[model samples]
Structure formats: C-alpha cells, structure tokens
Target: MESSAAKYCCDNINNHGSSSQSQTSTCMQKFRLYETRSNFYMIGRDKSRTYWRVLKIDRLDPSELNIREDSTTYTESECSELLRRIHEGNISTGGLRFVTICYGIVGFIKFLGPYYMLLITKRRQIGSIRGHNVYAVSKTEMIPVPNATVNSSIADSKDENRYKKLLCTVDLTKDFFFSYSYHVMLSLQKNLCNNEPGQFLYETMFVWNEFLTRGIRGHLQNTLWTVALVYGFFKQATLSVSGRDFKLTLIARRSRHYAGTR
Candidate 1:
C-alpha cells in the first residue's frame, strides 16, 4: 500500500506542479558509517541533510550481504537521539564508533574470503551538465564485512590476496564519472525523452555496479541509497569557432553486455 506521502507526491506530479521533481533530487548523497561488534550502521542524508535514514549491515556473516533499511524517516535531532541510545545500550561491548565518511557505495565483491564493501571515500567534481554535478572517484576503500577472527584461514590465503590486488589494479579515478541527480549512463536525449524511473535505469548495461547493488536494491525496493556509476570516459573542453567560443563535452559509455564478447 502506498503511504499518504507517496500518494501526495504522485498527485502533485499528475497536476504538473513544482512540488516534486525527479526522484534523483531526493536521493541520499552523503553517508556516515558506524560500527559495533556485530554490525555496521550507515546513516544517509539528503542534500539539505533535513531527511535521514539508517541502513543496517550484519557483520556476523562473512559469506552473505545482509542489509536492512529502517522504514522510519527521521529528523536531525531524532536521529542523534537514536544513535545516542544505541551507543548507551552497547557501551559494555565497545559501543558504536565512527568508521569513515563516504560519498557513495561502489559495490560489494567476494573473494575466497569474506565479502568486501567497496566505497567511494573521496570524489572530485570533474564537470557538470544541465546543473547536475558529475564527480570522479578520488579515492576508494574496501572494507571486509566480517572481523578478522571469522575467516582467518581464507582471508589470509594467497588466492584471496591475489584477487583483491587484481581488483585494485583498475584505477577508478581516471575515466569513471557519476552524477547524484543526473542519469549519466543515458544520453541527454534519452534522459529528456524517456520517463523511466531511476530504479529501472540502474539495471541497464551502462551501470557498472548493477550486479553489486542488486541485493540492496532488491531488499529496499528503491535506489535511494546507491549511486549509479557509469564506467567509461568523460571529457569537457573549450572550442573556438571563428571568433566564438563554445563548450564541448564528450561522454563514452561502455556496454557491459558486449564487454567480454568477441
């Protein structure tokens, strides 16, 4: 059943009012990670930081990604109070501690050991189109889901380290770019002409993190907590034609479907 808020949003859109625009406009862009002994709590906030939500990731399982999003929306004060209570309750067990701040989740990958969550820890604004900011990965982090004691033998294996090293060899900061509010994977024409929802677009070939985000997206039924990253090339430059200067931009999107095929 659609909640009153969702129904109101649809009604507002049907009337063509300015009350609600693209869903991307409301997607969470900033996140803070907190960790206890058995779980990782990720707090996400919107652009204004007015709306808040929490996602809980279980740390007890080394082989599976168990993610659950809290259904309640929270205000700044209420969220602080909730976190305070959580800390108080877990004080005897080395209470919740700040892990790291991240722009968005890259995805999760598993090796011979436990699953590692890839995160875009740092980003740089490379360019923009139609007022939407596009960012390139400046730095990334891969954190093991389970503690070291859980998978001691597998985590320290030579194959696991080799696989992890191979994954890190592909430099993400070079050509990859993503937008928080724009469908950077699709062309401008498709973006303007098509009215498809953001969640559907995420399943398309251009999004490199499609496979990685599938579990979380399926669990939450929304793409609000993840950013769709386009793996390809983006370049912007200035051109001079006869005495006039114009901005030129180029974007090349790699097709995941035909990537490894002959």
Candidate 2:
C-alpha cells in the first residue's frame, strides 16, 4: 500500500505541468493519498505525511527561499532571477583570488622588510667607519714574518699561499653594490619559512659561500670585497627563494676576479 501510494504521488507530480502551483497541488494530493491508505497505522501515516511535507518543500523553487529577504516579500520570479545573476557572475569581482594575491605579496614584503632595514643600517655603519682600519692589529698579527725562511723545494706551496692572499685581499666594493635582490630573496625565503616550503636555503648558502671564498677570488681582483658582499646578499636571497635570475646577472658583471686565474 505504501509503495502504491508513493507511486501514485510520483505519477501525479510527473503528469502535472511544471508550474509552482501544479507542483504544490501534486504534493498535497500525494499526502492525502498516503494518509487515506495508512489510516489504521498512525506511525506510518505520520512518517509518510512528514516525508511528503519535506518533498513539497524540496520541490519549491530555491530562488523564492531567501532567508535574508522578508518571507512576505519573496516572489518566485525575483528569487529565480537572483539565482540566475549569481550563476552568470553578475556579482562583485572581490573574491578570494584577488585577495589572496594581494595578501601574499604584502606578507612577502613584510617578512623581508626588516632585513632591508638592516642592510641600510649596516651600509651606513660601515660608511661612518670608512678609512679607519679597525682590524689593523689582527691584519698585522696574521702577516707572515718577513725574515722567516722556508725550504726552496716547497715552491709548489707558494701558489696556495698566493691564492689565500687573493681571497683575503679582494676589494668587495669594486665589484658589487647594494640592491633590492637580497631583500626580495630574503622576503621569498621568509614566505617559504612560514609555510616550510623548501631546502634551497641551506643547500645554496653552502655552495655560494664556498664559491665566494675560493672560486670567485681570482676574478674579483680589486672589487673582490664587493663581489663577496654581493655574493653573500645573493646567497641569502636565493635561500629565501625571492631572488630572481636577472639580478644574478648584474652581480656577475663585476666578477673580474675570475679573469686570468683558473
């Protein structure tokens, strides 16, 4: 009997026209049919009626069911039109995509902001101390004794000593200058750090520092110190992942230290 009543309700719904009123009428008819068939079974009658009510509510046009608008003011056509507009992208463009891009850029800059300030502070501090050899005593202490004699047969070791001297004496200012690359790289790294993104920082820093101490010394020459500074900056930035490829090119231009040497 329950199956027959349910089938009867479904048939009426299908046969009726698609108008909202027709849908409502079909629902009412189904409810009445179920009640009559299950008159003796109160529980079954109650369950069927409740099910029919839910089906009726579900059949109603969703557009006409605005919670924000007053129930008394809602109309089927108006609700349908609203839903259509939303589907067609007639709403504002201020969505998560735009907001996310904006926030990501801002957050990236914010993360690198302090490092930039520190760079400026360092530059100014060095500038203020210019012409004063603060490490003069240390330099004097490390210098080889002028009168010390070594075995002439060990001439091969002289090349190694020369290389070390070059590494220590290369003037960094001649080859490099302060720029935004480091800041950007640091920012990128910080952004990655927040999300725990990559291992580039550790790996690249080790390689870059080794390159600076040895590989870059011969070509850097008078600008050796500048190259070291720039290389350090690049290493930091690359570690952060904010460093771009083009800036590395700019830094490479001053790498004359690698010129005549292998």
Candidate 3:
C-alpha cells in the first residue's frame, strides 16, 4: 500500500499536477493526421515525443452530445457529411486543453447521475528491461457528457448541488486506478474476492458497454495489448556442453485474463 501510494504521489509530482495549463499545450508534442474513406485519424505525441496517442474525430449533431437519450444515433451518411464539413471548413480546436476528437474506445459505463467519460490525461512508461516498453496510466480526466438539461430552476431543491458534490468528491488518482501495463490489484481482499457480473474484472465487457464507439478502436484495436509483457521472467544464458555452445528455450502460455505480466 505504501509503495502504491508513494508511486501515485510521485507520478502526480512528475506530471506537476494535471490541471497545469502548460501541460495541455505539450499534451500532443507532435501529431500526424490521416484519413480513410470511412474515417479520419489524428496521431499525437507528448512533449517528449516518445509517447504517442491516436484519436478519431466524430461528426455528430449537437443534440447527440447528450448521452442520456438512446434514440440519438447517427447514420453513416450523416457521420460522413459531418466529417466532410469539418475538414472542408478547416475548423480546428487549435491549442486547447480539450481535444475535439476522441483517443480510443476502451469503454464507458452507465450511471444514474450523469454520463461520465473517462479520458487518459497522461501516461507514464514503466521500463523495458525485456526489450519491450510498458506504460502505466499516469493521469486521467473525467468529463461529464450532460443530457438535455438538469433542473436549473431557482426553486430546485438542495439535492441537485449535493449530487454534483458527490461526483466531484471523487479523487480519481486515489479512488480510481488504471494501468495500461499491468493488473494492479485494488486490495488484498479484492484480489481474493470472486467477481460478480458487470464488475471490475480485467476481461469484462460491460465496463465499455456503449454503442457510440469511435477513435483508435479500429478493425484491429489492440492498444491495451501494449501494457502486457509476455515472458520477461525467464532469463537466458549460454553454456558450453561437450565443448559446444548451447542456448535454452522456455515456452509459456499467457493467461487470458491478464496475459502480459509473468
């Protein structure tokens, strides 16, 4: 627990606080833009340029921004028309902390209060001793995709404020944890605990149970695979056997749930 806490603290310090305006400017150090007949792609880099991000832009009606209604769906033609108008107009966010496009489709969850969007704010690379690099989720930001409208009446009860407070009270760095690299257990008790349906199981589906998918989640969406290290555990050495050089080989079957770490 101490190590986890320390690491979290150090990561925040390393990021110099997620809210710093300067970080947003460097969020995408250098970027490349690509487009297909069906989609538009934006590949971004951090200030270091060692890091990379790929996002997709969606063209939807303003009304569709509200995640509450299920009826708000866009057909392929409409989506393309929207994309067509965007690039044709050369409209861009320019340099804002916000990205007009989306990164990838990890998934989203439905809740009672509001539609919450989990976005990766910053990612930290853990080490690549095994000739491969692994990254951990260094930071994230939560944006609420609001519905039509909440009761903004002057006579509205205090419960509205309380509800907002409840959501705002969450300290994502401490309360919610994520790592693109490894399955960091939540707690010892949780590790020993059997999961129920629709819970935080590693390979569960409902976490991202949403129809509105966009971004780097292409025909081959395998970004999550980057976090796992397959067989770095086995050490290799050469030896002389009968005056002949010999190499050792070990085969391992990775776990389906959490395959990378071994």
Candidate 4:
C-alpha cells in the first residue's frame, strides 16, 4: 500500500467526517466511558483529539446486547457539551457518572445471565512496523453491562462465578498485542500489496476477537469501537553476525483450528 493511503486509513479509522461534503479524520483511538442508570455512553476520539463520536450501550437488558452509534461527528467542544447535556438530563438517579478511560473495546461476552464488556484499560507500546505502532495489553477489565441490582440472582450464582474464573485464566495481558492502524495478522507482503475490505481482515482466522466483536460490527456496520487482538508470541533482538550487527524480529501467530491436537 502507498504510504499516503495507509496514513489516511489509519488516521481516519471510522472513515467519516464532521460534515457530508468535507472529509475529516475520526480515528477512534481513545475512549471515555460514562454511565447513567440505564445506559453507557462511550465517547471516542482520534489521536489529534479533533474528531469525536459516540456509542450508546443499553444497560437495562441483561440477556441481549444493545449498542447504537451516533451518526454525527463532533468537535471537541461540541462533544463535551453533548456529554454535559447527557449528564444533566439523567441527574435524577445519580446523573451520568464517569466510568473509566479505555484504549479500545476487547469485545462483549456473556455466560448464563447478563452480558459483560471486555475493555483494554491499559496498553504499552512493544514495537512498530512501517510506521504503524503495535501495543500489548497491560491491563483489562470485564464489567457487567447491567448493574448488580438488575442481575442479582444470576450474578451471584456459583456457575456464573466459575465461568468468570475460567475466562480469567486465559490472562490476556500475557501474550497478546494489536495495532489500531496496521493489520498485524496479515503478512508484511500482503499488508503492503493487498487492499482488502476492512471486514475481511476481522474475519480472518488469526483475529482472536472475531466472534466477540461480530455483534457490534454487524449492528453498526463499522469497527470504530473495538480492536482485534492477536495471540501467540513476539520478540525483537539485536545480534552480531560475522563481526556485523543485525536486527531480527520474530512473530508467532497461534492457529485456532488445530489448537489441542499437537
């Protein structure tokens, strides 16, 4: 791919602008989560902080995932004012409370009762390939969409706790990394030469969050709210060979198809 095209796609992850005729960047890199009694308002912005968008998650229903994306793109000040309005409108039942700042949505999952949202709360840069930064998950959070009062009975069940524990054992912070701009799962040659649809990238075998992100991606028809994490290994090192210095980078991607046999 051309450097200019890559940069344009990276900087404008959602491919939308503030106006119908003018095209501006809305990367959706950083997110601020706010919540009222019945809903979650996720505000996302680009790295430059010039463009912004909103995602609404309904918290009233435990059995289903309800997510809606606001079609308009806002300026920083306008986005803040919109948030203020939401806060003031919901002031009767504790107002809109600040939840947490997250880098990207890992995905949404559920057990027997309510659904839970997985968020990447912290990330650390590991390396970069062709000007695209790659990061490993430093910290993560799995928060139930519905409050404790809504799913009190099922939330406290033994089976539910056990399932949660089982999921935690995977330890996402260990050997997973992703890039908001680059398609890490694809080989370097393919990434450079192929101009595949964004949806095809997510549907590949290497993306660990494929199934988890399907619901929201299907609903909004875009991937502005999540990141596709790749599980396996990554390492970079410098070495001396024949009295000359050399650099080596290794990436190992785990295959989900034949995971347990060998």
**Per-candidate count of clashing residue pairs (backbone under 3 Å):** 0, 14, 3, 1
| Predicted model with the maximum TM-score | 4
Residue lDDT tens for model 2, 1-262: 2233333433433243222322222211111100111111001012123322211111111112100101111234443342243223312321111100000000000111110000111221111111211100011012121111221333226664565456447443232333211222233346345432112321233222223233112221111111112332222122224563421221122233343322
Off by over 4 Å in 4: 1-26, 238-247
Candidate 2 lDDT at 80 equals 38
lDDT of 4 by residue, 123-234 (tens): 9998877778889999999989986656758777999999999999989999898988888889888999977755678888889888888887777767778898998887
Candidate 1 at residue 215, lDDT? 72
Give the per-residue lDDT digits (tens) of candidate 1, residues 1-262.
Answer: 2223322422322333121234334778899998877678888898898988777777777788877666666799977876776676566667778999999888778878788988889999888888788999999999998866566688879899999999999888877889988899898999888788767998889998898888777766678777788888898888999999987889988877776533
Better of 2 and 3 by TM-score: 3
Candidates 1 and 4: which is better by lDDT?
4
Point to the candidate with the largest lDDT: 4
TM-score of candidate 3 relative to the true fold: 0.33
List TM-score per model, in order. Answer: 0.85, 0.20, 0.33, 0.86
Error of 1 at 208 (Å): 1.5
Considering lDDT, where higher is better, how would the candidates rank from best to worst?
Answer: 4, 1, 3, 2
Model 1 weakest 10-residue run by lDDT: 12-21
Whole-model alpha-carbon lDDT for candidate 3? 0.33
lDDT of 3 by residue, 45-123 (tens): 4434454433333222212221110111234454344334434433332211224332222333233343344554555
State the number of backbone clashes in model 3: 3
